[model samples]
Each structure stands twice: as C-alpha cells, then as structure tokens.
Target: ALVLEMKSLLGALGSSWALAFLCSTRWDWLRHSVLCTGRWHQVRRSVISFRRSWPGKIIMKGSSREWSGTMGQHNMLRFRAGQVDPMSRRLGNLLNMLMLGGQWDRRYYSCTVVVPENVMKDAQRVGRWVSRDDINTMGLLRHNWGESALADRYYPGLYKKLEEYHGVDFHESVMCWHIATDLILAKEEKEKEDFAADKRVQTVRALSNYMMFLLVNRPYMLPGLPQNWLYKQTCNNLDKICNDYDLVGSLGDSLWTVLKKLLGLHHHRVLESSGLEKKLADLIMKLPKEHASSFSETPRLLYARSVAVIILESGVVDKVRLLLDLWMDFLAYAANRCIRESHAQKLSTGGELVTIVWLILEHLRYLKEDPNQQHGHV
Candidate 1:
C-alpha cells in the first residue's frame, strides 16, 4: 500500500514539474529575463524541493493547467513589480492552507429529542405510538393527522393571517410567531400544567427562540432580504414599553441590566418573563378599535400579541396542541424555503436543525414520489 502511494505521489510530482517546465519554456520573456540568472536556477531548485514534500504533493493535486496559468501570471507580475520572493511565499501559504484546513475541530449540532412526560410514564407501546404519531416529536408527515385536523377545524381568519405573514414576508412571519410563542409560554406559566416539563411546550419554545436567533445573528441563513429595519424598530418599541411600565428590574437599571432582563437570564426569568408579558398584553389591549390602522408602524409585533390572545382562549390542551401545530409548520416552512448554499455554509461551522429538517423533508418527499415505494410492505 505504501509503495503504491509513493508511486502515485512521485507520478503526480513528475507530471506537475513537467507541466511547469513546458509552460515556462513557452513563455520566452519569462525564461530569458527570469530563469537564465544563476540565482534564478537556485530559486527554481528550492521551489522544486518544496514541491517534492507532502504538502507540495497536495498542492500539485490541484489542476496543473490552473496552477501553471496562475504561476505564469504571478511570475509576470512579480517580475514587473521587482518582487521575486512573494510568488514563492504566496504559493507556500496556499500549500499551508491545503495542509491545515482539515485539522481544525468542527462543532457538530443536532436537535434535542423531546420525550413527553406522559410517554416517559406510559408503557413502551404507548411510547412507540407517540413517537410514530406525534408531529412535534417526529415532524410533519405526508398524511399528518395534525395537518388534516388544522385544515378542517382551524379558524379561517387565523389561517389567513398565517398565510398573510408567510406570503408577504418570511422574516416578518418569524418575528410575529416568535413574539406570540413567547407571550403564550409566559401565559402558560400561570396554568396548573408544568410547562417546563411538557415536551411540546419545550419544542415550541426552542424553535421560536431559534428562529429569532437566526433572524438576529444569522439573517443570511433565513429566506428573503433580512428585515433589519423591522427587527430594530420592534426592539426599540419593546424597550419603550418596558421603560414605560418599568417592566425591567428597576427604573434606574443600566442598559446592560435591561438587556439581560430582555434576554431572560436564568435569575431574572420569573420577574422579567411575567412583567414583560403583562405589559405586552396591556399594550395589545390598548390598540385602537380599528385594528388595521392602530399599530401600522409595528404591525407584526402587535398582530402577534393579538394572535397569542386568540390562541389563549382555547382550552389548555387545545391551546398547546394548536401552538405545537403552528411551530412545526413554521419549522418545516422555513426549512423548505431556505437556500441550498446557506445549508452548505453551515456544514463548515456546525450544522443547523433547520438543515437537518430540510434533509428529512426532502428524503420523505423522495420516498413519497418513488414508483417502488407504493408497493413496499411495512
């Protein structure tokens, strides 16, 4: 194996050197002006020695034509510029990158698998059923019961609102849903149910925060032109609301303190979460009777608050079920619409949940469309 590897390495080096020599010979001015000098021959020998090394082998593995073409161009430029060492230096740097690029640790990312408290408490058969049937845990399927249920019985106006949010602008939709989800989660804290332990509730919260995080930090990963103005405007208005109501720690708190509260620090969660939601709820209540014109400037945020109120009117179980449906749909929607390059870029850093979801959806779609899949037994 080692002998074969060595033979291949020598073959590649010999080919590259031969290509380089041919190109150099064709360029008469480069040969006469640069190569004939005694010092130039020494430099050429040094470059060839460097090329014989393993890193050089990797560099030589690239397109010989491109490498030679680039080398000739750089040679002319360096000759004109009266800088001979920089071409070799630049080549060394390229070789270094090729050698070192794969050595760095890549952070791997994965979505958390949520097991509902009931699933944990129940028998394995029941757990298996939930795993197979639950959209929140599994993801949207071709014949999802939740999808059918929502299509059949959900409010037409709410469905229209969702369509509006999506069709008009995706970033706006994400912000709207994120705000509503946050408010709803805060509201649920007051209920008898243990929200922190509920799998669906946690899933809703995770995806909501994640979408917002992408909007703020990784806008390129999301679809559409990022609505920077909308995000900034909404944030400023929320700050004003917090300031007016003193919903943060105190009236005299520093900017950082207020920001910490806004971000929901572990210590400030109870205080800030409830206070902010109450203020937002009150603000939603105070909007003018004419809903269309009242909050025209910051409409999505207010509209989201209103949506949260409507969702809240349902029974706790129904409300949670409704929210779970909405968030899962949102997750799938974002995944489907996101560009391929964004997903590819995330691979070098850490992978994203949305990219994974996108892959799953694409695979499922392929399976659904396959001619052979229809006849397969379970």
Candidate 2:
C-alpha cells in the first residue's frame, strides 16, 4: 500500500514535469510579465466605452508592449445565478444545455452561458459566422447554414436525450459556435498575454488544450468536416513542426506553406498563389472552407468574444473582472476535470489535457488514477 501511494505521488509529480517539458517550446513564447496574483493597482477612468480608449487595458512594459487589464475590478468571481436574460433562462431546461444555470457549470462550463443579446449583441461582427449570442438556437438564423456533424462526445446521447425529452434540435452548429466562440475568447486572451503578464502561461495552456479538444474529441465544432480530413494529425504535426522550426508567436504564412507541403494540400490547388492567413483555428486544425467558407461557420470564432466586447463596452469593472475570473476558473476546471476516461477514452485520441495540454498535469493525473472515486471511466 505504501508503495502504491508513493508510485501514485510520483506519477502525479511526473505528469507535471512532463507537461512542462512538453510545452517548454510554447512556454518560451509566453512573454515575460510580472505575476499579478495579489497586486491590484487600480486606475480609475472617466471613459464609459471601450470605443475610444479600450475600456480597461494598460500597456505593460517589456514583452512586446502587450495589453493586460485589472482583474481586481470585481468583488465576485462567480456571477449571480439570476443574472442571465430571459431567453437564456429558458435554455436552462436541458441538461448541459442551460449553461451558467447552476454553480458548477457557471464556474466551469462557462463559455456557453450565452450572455443575452439585449446587453451584449451589438458590440462587433467580424464575420458572417459571427451571429447573436444564443446557445439554445445555436446562434443560427437559418437551419440551412450547413449540415451539422454530431461529435460522439457531445451528440447522439445528448441529442437523443434532448429529443426524447424536450423535442428540440439542440441546434448543433450554433451550439458548436458557443464552443468555438469559447475558443476565440481563449485565443484572444492568448494574444493579449503575448504582450502582458498576469496569467499568461495559464491562458496559453488553456487555449492550447481547448483547441485540441475541438480538434480531437469534438469534430462537431467543425461541421461538414470530411472524415478523411486528417486535421487532428496535421495539428499535432504542426505542434512538432513549430517546435522544430522554432516558430513561436504568430505562426507566419511560411509555416503554412510548410504545412501544406507536408500534408499534400499544396498539390491540389491548381488556381494560383493564395496566401493563407494565420488564425489559431487554422493553425490547429483543418477548418472546412478555411479561406473561403469562414471555417464552415461551425465556430464563427470569437463570436463570444464580440459579446465579451459588449461587457467591456459596458464599462462595468465588475463585469469585466468577473469574466476574467471565470476564464481563470475555467482553466483550473479543465486541468482538474478533463482527463477522465469518461471524458476522453484514449490518451492518443482525447484532448490535450489527457496527453499534453493540461495546465496542471499533477491534479489531472491524480483525478485520472483515483479508482476510489467514481468518475474518469464512468
């Protein structure tokens, strides 16, 4: 028994070092910024909207002039349960459907809370895929946008459960957009952290893990994706290639050229020299209609981010800070909860948390191996 305990403890520690060693490449790009855990330097502003002076961002010294904001602007990290709008309140009827309806989901599965349109819809629209915030209807105005691909992790059982009980389509693409938008915000955090400090590494790790989740466990995030797309493999390959080429920061188009050549995608294009844009979604996965189709509209990356802009635009320090705390909480949540076999069947085919992307591998390792507990495999 003592040997077992020691092995368990060592395994836990090993996972942490393994994750750090594995991501040492990405860590190099995390940019040096002071850790602002207990530091709260408040700068009061008369500006009401971010339309002029960017709401709350302060330019940090070093790390390429990156922008980071105050996280202590709120009195609470968890939101009031009744804070949602009427439409969002109605969505609370379905299991895992109504996000932020309870304490656990609000604190963890928070990206899907669907903060109402009345308060958050008109901030910005960067793409056609960027629609209103509606997780229930999936931010879809019409059903003909694209045929949905139900991923094994989120659909079938979820769909059947909803259908058998509530008689709703669950709006697969739109729901996926929630997860997609979820990622967009994470990516945005990553971009900002590139220049600022605070929790930069944590944000990057979360974004990396979340991207891996979308690519591996949830193909529904990429609707109409071909079965033979090989995007997941390509993404892993890019991670390796980026490491090999020392291509940190914004993976420039040159890496895409190498990636296209590596994947034989360069051979199929007969038309011309089209430059590929460096997008996180594109960098990590083979997005359908990547250049032309707005990533098949399954994600509409940063749609949720636009909603985030509204909160910032509201100029409520508490709202912005609340969101910041929630994101940090999510990072913690993924590290602790995402490694179970019930959540991911195989380390090879599962999310980065199961393999490489988890922020705190020791906690996840403990969760995965605790047989006395009921989760992981169930």
Candidate 3:
C-alpha cells in the first residue's frame, strides 16, 4: 500500500511530459528513487549528486527534496502512532507545512503559533536565516520595497506563537523605522537633516517617550556618561525653545523658574552656602524605607557623594551646588542600597554612577569659568 501511494505521488509530480521524459533514464531512476523514499539522509545525498551534475537544477530539486523529507517523516510518525510524542508530531507537521510553502496560507495557522518544545531546536535553526542585519540590508535596497521575501515567508501568522510567548510585538512601526535609521546612518554623510525633516515631531516625541521609559523602567541601562542620545536630545529641545522664542526675557525667565521648581530648588538660590550633609540627611529621611534601601545599595550614591564633596570643597553655595547636592544624595542612597544587597554586584552601575558624576562636575566647571571672564574684564 505504501509503495502504491509512493508511485501515485511520483506520477503526480511527473505530470509534465518533459519532467517524466527526464526521469526515465537509469541514472534518473536511481536518483528519483532515492528522493522518493522521503528520508532526509537519502534526499540530502540525492540533492548533492544532482548539484554536482546539474547545478542549475539544484534549487528547484533541493526545495522538493526538503519538502519530501519533512512530509515523509511526518507520515512515518503518523503511521507509527505511539512512536512519536504529541509535541514531536506537532513539530513534524509544522515543519512539513513550512517546507511545502504553507507560510502564505493564513487558514493553515493563526498569527500566533505556540511552538512545541520538541521543535524548539528546529525553530532556532530556521530563525538564523532571518536576522536584524539581513532585514536592515534588505530595507535599504530600493528595488526590493514591494514585498519582502523574508516577511512573506515567515511573518505575522508563521511565527505567531513564538511572538506571543516571547512578548514580541512584530507590528511596531517605530522598531522598523529604528532599524532603517541604523542602516541609513551607517553611510558617511550625516542623515540628521533627513531624519529631522521626515515627521520630525512624531519621531522626536517617540524617541523622547522611549528614552523616558528606559530611564524610568530600565534605569540600569543608562550609562554614567552625560554625552549620550538622551542628553543630546534634551539639549536640542532647549536650543529649539531658545531659538524659537524670546527665552531670556519673560518666557525664558518663566521657563528657568519652572525648571528650578521641578529640580526641587525653587526656594534655593543658585549661589547659597548651604550645608550639604544636612540637606542629604533630610532627603534620605524623606525617602520611603524601600526606596531608601535601594538608593543606598546603588553605586550612583558613591558618585553623588563625590560630587557633593567637590561642591563643598569649592566653598561655593550656588544654584548649581544645591542641585548637584540633591542629585548626588538621591544617587548615593540608591548606590548604598545596591552595595549592601547580596545579589546586586553589577559593575555597569558603578560605571554609570561615575559618568554622571563627571558630567555634573563638567557643568559646574563651565558655569564657574563663564562667570570668571566677566570678573576679569571688570
């Protein structure tokens, strides 16, 4: 019965008279017989032989061989019944369908397909075919814009289960844009103007929201250095406001006042000789117990403490000093908690803390130097 079924399938595959004619010879029979067995090892060997003799026919022949191998395995498993586990059966069926170009058939599966554990290894093997770099490279080529071969082959429903399981939202437009931007920026010329002009407001807002989310939700990702995309964006926004409006007079004064209030230094003048330790102690006491503990364990606290020492040693109590002191105290508390914690020995936190400390110090140096020139001229 199995041999009869195989003969019928082979006859169906040889529907074209030219294909039947080509498979009639003795060598062709041997090759086709091995491929018809549907065993992966036999199919692979047949594919190798075909490639060696007729390289041009390998692609089409290889695809059929692959499909046959998967289909044969699936049929064998089905017939054996108890030979394969539920997960293995599901995986075999999925692989067979995938090999046979069922990716475009929406009815075959849903947008989210939960992968069985038995097929996870095979899934990973297939995943290597589609990578971020490959996607980006394809995105840049204008000739390939209409329909991505990769997306058509494995998107939306094809990997739906894995997407849901991994919490990956495949429909995020911003992520697509980000990938495209990375590719665009890799060129020598600056693409800033193009980026700024193309839906500038929306892009800026999205980036701002993303940065804020990272800062709040994943604070550990933030580097210690002040000169990063986030900081640059903040400065750019300030510059835009200054250029677009009269900031120095009424609007600017109001903006500065509001900013100071937000920084928790509205009452404290820029130049006031305040006691640093007392203010820090007050801040520490005001924090909730859990927050205090977390703050104390962070390395940022050490960096903050170092900044406070620098400010106090300079013997200047100005707005900058006050802001620095408050900032440092908050970081110090977090750092102290991390340090005391048993499982919080992350070196990146220490690096970030040091970076922030140096940035704050740089700002102070700039402020002091700017004022000194006026004094010297006078």
Candidate 4:
C-alpha cells in the first residue's frame, strides 16, 4: 500500500510539471529542442497516441486525423465534447484554450493581412495609421474613394459600382457584398482559362468566404447590430427561390455540406471545392427577368445579382484587380473595427486571422511611432 501511494504521488508531481512546462512560453524552444535532439519521432508518436485517447478525443468531434494533421503543429484546431470522462474532457478544453497554439486557415495566408502593400506604402509616407478612423463601413467607403491610392489609380471606376450599394448598416453591406461575390465567383466556373491560378482571384474568393464564415458563425465579432433576422430571412428567401426552380434538394445538400465544412465538422477533400458555389450559380440562372420589389424578402438577393451583373461587365483583369483591392480593404476595416475584447476571447480555442491582422497593424503602428525601439520588444 505504501509503495502504491508513493507511485501515485510521483505520477501526480510528474503531471503537474508537464502541465507547467506546456503552459509556459517556451513552446518554440521546445519544438527546436526536440528537432535538434533527434527525438521528435518518439515525441510525435506519443503525442499522436494521446490525441487518439479519450482526453484528446474531446478536442475534435470528427476524425482527429481529418480535422487537424498533427498534435501541436500550426494547423487549425477545434474543440468539441467527446466520449470522455467529464473531468478529463474539461481538462482537455482548459488545456486547449490556454496553451494549444495554432494558425488560422491556410487559405488566408495569401491575404495581405500582415503587411498590405498599399497600406505599407501609405504608412511609410505618413508614418501613422492611415485607416485609424476609417474602421467602420462608411469610413472605409470614404477612404476607398481616393485614399486607397493604388486601388483608385488602377480601378477608378470601381467606386461607382461600390456607391450603388452604400448603406449605414455594416451587416447589410457585408451581406450584399457577400452575395455579389458569390455570384461573380460562380460565374467564373465557366471561364475557359485557369482563373483559379490567379492569386488576385484566389484572394478575393478566400476573403469573401472568410467574411461569410464570420457573419454566419461569429456575428458578434463583427462591428454591427445583431443580424440574426437578416441572415434567417436571406436563407429563407434563398430556399424559396431554390424551391421555385425545383433546385431545393440540391441547394439544401450543398448548403449543408458547406455549413459542415465551415464549422470544422470535417476536413475538405484534397482536390475538391465545396458545391455551394455551383448551386448558387444554378439559382442565379433561374432568377426572374424582372427585379423583386424593394419590400420583398429577396430584395438583397436581387440587388446583389444586379451588382454582380454590373461588375461582370468589366474586363476580367479589371474585375479581378478591383475585387482583390476591395477585399483587402474589407479585411483591414473589419479587423480594425472589431472589439479588443472579442479578439481576446478568441485567443483561446485557436486564434483568428482577424485577430492576427489587428495585432500586426498594432505592431506596425508602434514601429512607425518609435523607429528606434528594438524588434524583440514588441
């Protein structure tokens, strides 16, 4: 009995020490140390074993292999209740929230979130935050007119299309733009050339989908009033339209697939894209020739479709450039306007791209203000 008690005490102390080390800010050092010592293979096997066990299983609802590739890598991570003891599950949640470091979606790495080319030029010229006060939608619109120098110089006609959808509410603006972006992207499927290879087009698509993901799943993180009613009404109107065209079955299936993919229910297949865009394209082709009434529930849909038509009228080069610049602005504006507390809350359970963008901008601001400050201080 005494020997058993000693073993239990030693185990407890070992676990406590392990937890302390994991929670400390030495993860980078640890990763490097394991790599230098040639013991990463063993450590990786042990981590994967733990990941497959009950405690770690609670962190992922779907297949752990499909959700995130490695245990402590830079892949996106998620948390869910799994078939584990309640106490162990809670511990898993706590550990993930406190110490599990992961990056945002790999798709967003192409976005100029860390150092936007135009924003960088402006910052160097003015030595301050150019969009300091232009964080909200209206201010962003005003700034984009002439202040976004590169965009204006290249896509001078873009603002005319933008002005057509100007509004006071940020939620309404995001929905309108999102719908328009979807329509345009769906049409691009018919292009003969490999449009997907274009980085500008890729950026546009990524930011557009990312904004919708936030709108549907994390609306509170955005700078606007609750848009629950608007989102539901939009979905309902979309369902009605799909039903009218007898495409409801396909539409529902596509939307369900997309929702699951967005919520991290599973990982996307290697070479396939979501069916949502294709379904939306089919729906667009079935719209009535005449526009819907302003009071109709589907007014936003009609408006966005019309906007897509106007945008599509431009040359392919112009369309891609205009949209790429516009999305960069939208990303920056949203990141700037989001509340600090919202960012803090997301630090746990895998950080967000917007939060990272905001932090980068803050760091740039500090650098611009104090050029002599050491790099490591930030």
Note the Cα lDDT for every prediction shown.
0.48, 0.29, 0.28, 0.49
Which residue runs does candidate 2 get wrong by more than 4 Å?
1-306, 316-324, 331-351, 354-378
Looking at candidate 2, what is the lDDT of residue 148?
20
On the 0 to 100 scale, the lDDT of residue 320 in model 4 is 63
Report clash pairs, candidate 1.
none
Could you give candidate 1's per-residue lDDT for residues 163-190 as a string of tens digits? 4343257788777767776667666766
Model 3: per-residue lDDT, tens digit, 197-252?
A: 33322222223223222233334433232223432233233233233332222111
Q: Per-residue lDDT for 1-378 in model 2, tens only?
A: 785565344343333343445445355433122112211111111111221253112221111111121111100011111222233223333433645333332322222111223111111111112122211232222322221211124223322322222212222322333233333343444456442233432332233233333433343432334332333232233334334334334222354543343232332211111122123333433323433233333222323233334433433333223333333333332323342442343232222222222323232233443453232121
lDDT of 1 at 370: 46
At residue 335, candidate 3 shows an lDDT of: 27
Ten-residue region with minimum lDDT total, candidate 2: 70-79
List residue ranges in candidate 1 displaced over 4 A.
1-150, 153-158, 161-167, 193-196, 250-294, 314-317, 368-378
Worst 10-residue lDDT window for candidate 4 reads 73-82
- Which residue pairs collide, candidate 4? none
